[model samples]
Target: MKAQMFDMTRMWGMVTGLVLAIAYFASLYLGFKASEMLPMLVTAIGGFEMFLFSQDVWIKRKRKHG
Candidate 1:
């Protein structure tokens, strides 16, 4: 099947999540404060990605059962 826009979005979300996680850890390892904003931003983006992933699963299940 051809890739859908949602698929592309999920891919990007995965990449973004990885990058953010690495940056957050690297900052700490480098002896820098992760500042207040970084963690919040990561959490917000991670939540959004989780939502997208769940939606994808729900869609697949619906199609399979129906």
Candidate 2:
């Protein structure tokens, strides 16, 4: 039997994506516009997730090559 590592970064990314999707649909359903700041907030969160994923990849590569 093999054990798999739990990836918090991936989990967070999925959660963020799900929340954004739900918010978008809910706003549409209720006939209300999303706030102007929503896009900026999403961008910031996505950027942070990308940074975390890149860092994880870099660390794994470093360990593999060293």
Candidate 3:
């Protein structure tokens, strides 16, 4: 299958979200809790975005083959 612009955009977004989530986790581990709720919010958004992008890829591949 050919690579599309939308796929690239999604991949970048997923990577960025993952990175942000990791950074937030590290900060929390180091006791950098400037705001308790913000870290949870960021983690939730990042995890959701990752899940959505992964589901999109799986569905596209399944559709193409089946």
Candidate 4:
């Protein structure tokens, strides 16, 4: 069996996306009403990109494994 090769760029992007999402949700739940919504919107777009990239990665991984 071959070990999976991980790409650092994708990993970093994913990590950053997750952090952004966590912070956004945290601020929202913390009653930060004065918080600007622009950052949240940006984070959501970033999250969507990250999700699509990861899904593609998953499909590639499955193909490799099978």
Which candidate's lDDT is highest? 1
Q: What clash count goes with each model?
A: 0, 0, 0, 0
Model 3: how far residue 6 lies from native, Å:
0.7
After TM-score superposition, what is the CA distance of residue 6 in candidate 2 from its true location, in Å?
12
Clashing pairs in 1: none
Model 2 off-target regions past 4 Å? 1-17, 25-31
lDDT of 3 at 35: 61
Model 3 misplaced regions, further than 4 Å: 1-3, 34-66
Q: What TM-score number comes out for model 1?
A: 0.75
Clashing pairs for model 3 are none
Kindly list the per-residue Cα lDDT of model 3 for residues 1-66, writing each as its tens digit: 355876776677777767777777788789886466656766776777778779989999999999
TM-score of each: 0.75, 0.63, 0.52, 0.48
Of 1 and 4, the candidate ahead on TM-score is 1
Query: Candidate 4's residue-wise lDDT over 1-66, tens digit each?
Result: 122234555566667777766777787889775357648665776876768789999999999999
Query: How far off is residue 25 in model 3, in Å?
Result: 0.5
Clashes in candidate 3: how many? 0
Ranking by lDDT: 1, 2, 3, 4
RMSD of 2: 4.7
Instruction: Report how far residue 22 has shifted in candidate 4, in Å.
Output: 0.3
TM accuracy, model 3: 0.52
Question: Of 2 and 3, which scores higher on lDDT?
Answer: 2
